[model samples]
Target: MLPWIQLATAKVPGGGELRLMRRGEEFSIRLDANELMNSRLGGSEEALATLACQKLAGRPRPRVLVGGLGMGFTLRAALKVFGTDATIEVAELVPEVIDWGRGEMAGLYGDSLTDPRVSILQRDVGELIRAGAGRYDAILLDVDNGPEGLSRPANDQLYDSRGLSDARAALRGGGVLAVWSSGPDDSFTKRLRRSDFVVNEVPVRAVGKRTGSRHWIWLAVKT
Candidate 1:
């Protein structure tokens, strides 16, 4: 077995550090001791964009805001569904993650990053959500493990009442706010409903197959 090799490290905003590791052909991004994302298991992350894009289908020139750029799986999946006219704004707090995608894991990202419809924002997703109202047709968030913060405490605001409200306002009517989580959170589901979003919780496989740890996706539509 090939031992895991440390490729690069990036400091997380607020605190902590994220280490990029590679084992053979597989790559993994870790926040401290916890694994954030693995190159091999991207089913749920892809679902995060696909599910939201399915709801936004037929909309002319759909605008999407992707919170995190984990391996570019979600962005790639969105690009597959959207056409040349669609615009995707990817907000990644850590710049090194983008570098990894353009460097060591360039093949994993393919040309999604260079696509004309996509814009890379090296900033916080929460700020983008709060920047304007009704700016996006779909807002996909996969920033943390779940609603709760892991790497940065500031992430907690994104899932809180105010954050959800900002997200709701940021979406056009009937637009979707899809969130990818490591697991389910009933309270967060309730909060979505309270924020006036029609919520649908979907269970997806981490490996995009029938057998793997189940990850949850919250597809909340602005009502």
Candidate 2:
């Protein structure tokens, strides 16, 4: 077995640092000692896009906003489902993660970043959500471990009451807000309902199969 090699490090906005690591062909993004995401475990991330894209499949020229660019899995999955007429806006707070996708992990990202339908924003996704009104056909958030903050404290706002309301307002009618979580949060589901979204909690595997740990994806459609 090969030892993990540290590729690069980046500072998180609110606090803490992110370390990108590579072991053989596998890549991982870590916060302190905890692994945030891995190249191999992209099942739920892909599901995040697939489930949301399924909702917008009939729309002509769908506009989507992805809250995180973790290894570009979500973006790539979305690009696969969306046609050339679709537009995808990826907002990643950590710039180095974007760099990793284009640099060390370029093979993992492939041409997804260069795809004409995709746009990269090196800023907080929350800011983008707050700044827009009925702007997107769907919003996919995989920023933190769950509704609770893990890497950055400020990320908590993205799942809070006001934040969810802002996200609701940012979407076009019937737009879906799909969120990835390490586990389930009953309160978050309740909050989603209170914000006038039709919420669905889906249990997905970490690697798409039934082998790994179960993760959750919250599909909240604006009502």
Local error of candidate 1 at 69, Å? 0.5
Task: Go through the candidates in order and give the clash count of each.
Answer: 0, 0
In candidate 1, which residue ranges exceed 4 Å CA deviation?
A: none
Q: lDDT values of the candidates? A: 0.92, 0.91
Per-residue C-alpha lDDT of model 2 across residues 1-223, encoded as one tens digit per residue: 9999998999998778999999999999899999999999999899999999887657888999999998888898998887778999999988888898899999989999999898999988999999999999999999889898898888999999999999999999989999999999999999999999999999999886686779999999987
Off by over 4 Å in 2: none
* Candidate 1 structure quality by residue, lDDT tens digits, 1-223: 9999999999987879999999989999998899999999998899998889888867989999999998988999999887778999999999999999999999888889999999999999999999969899999999988897788999999999999999999999999999999999999999999999999999999986696789999999987
Question: In candidate 2, how many Å is residue 212 off?
Answer: 1.3
TM-score of 1: 0.98
For all predictions, the C-alpha RMSD in Å is: 0.8, 0.9
Clashing pairs in 2: none
Query: What is the lDDT, from 0 to 100, of the residue 55 in candidate 2?
Result: 74
